[model samples]
Target: MLNLETLSMDQYSFVANAFSFGLAVMASTTIFLWLMRSSVAPAYRMAVTITGLVTAIAAYHYLQIMLSWEHAVSIETGEVVATGEPFNRAYRYVDWLLTVPLLLIELILVMKLSQQETINKSLKLGGAAALMIVLGYPGEVAETIGTRMIFWILSMIPFLYIVYQLVIGLKESVDKQPENVKGLMHIAAYLVVASWAFYPLVYLLPLAGVTGGSAIVAVETGYTIADIVAKAVFGLFIFTIAVRKSEAEAGASGTSASKKA
Candidate 1:
C-alpha cells in the first residue's frame, strides 16, 4: 500500500551514492590506521578498531536503505524488490546503540592519554553514559505505542551525556590555558551538539505522513545525511583528537625517559 510515485528515484540514488561513498572513505581510513598501528597508542588503537567496526555497521545500514528503496520501487510495479521487511530502521537504532558508547569510551581514553588529573571522574562518567545508552536498546525491541516514547526518552540520554562532557571538557581546557586543546575541545563540543540538533527535525518529519504527504522520503533522506555528518565526519574529528593526544603522550614519555637516563 506504499506509493513509490511519491518518491523520486533520482533523489534516492543521490542519497544512496553519497552514503556509499562516505562508507568507502571510512573503510579506507580504518585500513590506513591499521597499517600505521605502531604510531598509535594502545588505547587509541582500540578506539580506531571500534570506530571502524561502527563505520562498517553504518555502511551496511545505508546499503539496506538503498535496497529498501529499490524494493519499494519494484513493489509499485507488482514485483518483489527483495525479501522480508526493510531492516534500515532497525540497523539505524542499533548503530546508535553501538556508536554512543564507543564514542564515550574513546573520549575517556583520550582524557587518560592527555594525563588529565580528573581521569577517574571521566572514566566514571563515561561508564555511566555507556550504561544509559545500553538501557536505550530495549526500546528498539519494544512493540506498541509505548515503544516510540521509550525510544525517544532513552535516546535523549546520550545527548544529555555528550552535552555534559562537552561543557566539562571546554571548561577544563580553558582552565589549563592551552590554546590547541581549547580549540579542539570547542570544535568537538560543537560537533556533538550539532549531531543532537538534527534528531528533532528528523523525528518530526514523520508527522507529515499523516497528511498523506511524501514525508517518509524526506525523513529517510534527512536521517541519511545526518548520520553521515554525525557518525562519519564528526567521528573522524573525534578520532583525530585521540590520535593527537596519543602522539603528545608518546613524545612526553620519550623525553622523560631520556632525561632520567
Candidate 2:
C-alpha cells in the first residue's frame, strides 16, 4: 500500500476533482481524435489514429486511478480520513510506460520521413521514452531522498536524450515540414519538452520540502495537468500535421471531406 495521509477537506477535494477532470478530458479527447481520423488522408491516418490511441490508453488509466482514489479515502463528518485503502500510484507509471513511447511514435509517423529515417528515429526516441519512464519509477517509489535523487539522476540520462532529439536531432525534420505546419511542429516539440519537464519536478517535490499531503496533491495534480497537454493537446498537433501533410502531398485524401464533415 502507498503512504496516503489525511488530507484537509480542501486537499482531498482538490485531488479528487483533478482526477475526475482528467478522466473526462481524456475520455472526450479519445473520442474526438478517433472520430476525426477518417477526415485525414490514408497515409496520415495512422498518425492521427495513434494520437487517439494515446488518449484512449490515458483515459482507461485515469479510470483505474479514479476508482482507486475514490476507494482510498473519504470525509467522516467533515474530517478527511483514510478508509484503510491506499491509492495505487503505480497506475500512473503503468500509464506512462505504455503511452509515452506511442506519443513519440505518433509524432514521428506523422512527419512522413523516409522509411529508413522513420524507423531509426522511431526506435531511438520510442526506446528512450520507455527507458526514461522505467528508470524514473524507481525514484518515484523510493522512500529516502538519497535513493530518489540517485534514480532521478539516472532517469535524466534518457530525458536529456529526448530533449536532444527534440531540439537538435529532430530540427531538420521539423524544418522540412510543410510551411503551413512548420510553426506548429516547433510548438509541438517545445510543448513536449516543457510539459514533460513537469513530471521530474513533481517527482522531486518532497526533496523541495513539499512533503506529506501537499506533496501528494502536487504530484497527482501536476501529473494530470501535464498528461492533458502532452497527450490531448499534443494529439491535436499530430492531427494537424497529418492533415497538412496530406493536403501537401499528391492524391491526398479527405481535404473536402474534412471541410464538409
Candidate 3:
C-alpha cells in the first residue's frame, strides 16, 4: 500500500460514488418500507415500521458520511487532495450502534414469539449488539497492531455470542414460526450472520497488509454494500415475513368463520 496523502482521481471517485450510492439505497428503502406498512397486519406492522426506522437512521448518517468524505478530499488539477479535514468515520459507528440492536429487535418481533420470549430475547440480544459495536470502535481507531487485536478479540466476544443466540438459542423459536415464513426466517438469520461478519473482515484490512488509498476505497465500498444488504434488503425480508404471517392468520380466521357458519 502506497502512502496516499493525495489520492488519484480514480481512488477518490470510487469512494465518493460509494457514499452516494449508499445514501440512495438507505433513503429509498426507508420510503418503500413505510409506504408498504399498511399491507401487513397491525401486530406485525411495528416490525415493518422499525425496519423503515433503521434505514431512516442509516440514510441520515449516510448523508453525513457523504459530506464527510467530500470535505476530506478536494479535486484540484484533476487530482484528489487531502484538505486537512479528516473524514469522520464515527458517523458509521454511530449509525451501527443505533440500528444494529433495532435490526435484531425487528427480527425478533416479526417472529411473533410469545410475549415473554420476545421480551427476554430482545433485551438480551439488543444489549449484545450494542456491546459488539462499542467494542469494535476502539480497534477501528487503534494505531497499534496489538491494541487493535485486543479490541478485536473483545468485540468478537459479543459478535459470536449474538450469532450463537441466533443460530442455536433462537432455532426453536424460528422453527415454530408459521410454515410460510419459517424458511424466510432461516434466511434472515443467515443474512444477518453473513453481512455482520463482513464488518470484521473489513476491520482487518489493515492487518491483512492492505493500507493507504486502496484500503480506504475497500473499506468504504465494502461497508456501503454490507449496509445495503443488512438493512435495506433485510427490511424487505421483514416486510415479507409480516405479509406472509398476516395472510396466514387471515386465512385461518376465515376458515374458522366458515366452520362456525
Q: What's the TM-score of each model vs. the native?
A: 0.70, 0.93, 0.95
Model 1 lDDT, full chain set: 0.58
Against the reference, the lDDT scores of all candidates come to 0.58, 0.87, 0.89
Candidate 3 lDDT tens digits, 161-258: 99999899999898888899999999999999999999988888788878777777778899999999999999899999998998888778986435
Model 2 stretches astray by more than 4 angstroms: 1-3, 250-261
* Candidate 1 lDDT, 99-173, residue by residue in tens: 655655554454444656446545655565566556655654555436646665776776576676667744664
Tell me which of candidates 2 and 3 scores higher on TM-score. Answer: 3
Question: Could you give the C-alpha RMSD of every candidate to the true structure, in order shown?
Answer: 4.8, 2.6, 2.7
lDDT of 2 by residue, 72-165 (tens): 8777887777788878889999999999999999989988899999999999999999999999998888878999999999999999999999
Which sequence of candidate numbers ranks them by TM-score, best first? 3, 2, 1
- TM-score, prediction 2: 0.93
lDDT of 3 at 133: 94
Question: Lowest summed-lDDT stretch of 10 residues in model 2?
Answer: 250-259
Q: How many collisions per candidate?
A: 0, 0, 0
Which should have the higher TM-score, number 1 or number 3?
3
Q: Give the TM-score of candidate 3.
A: 0.95
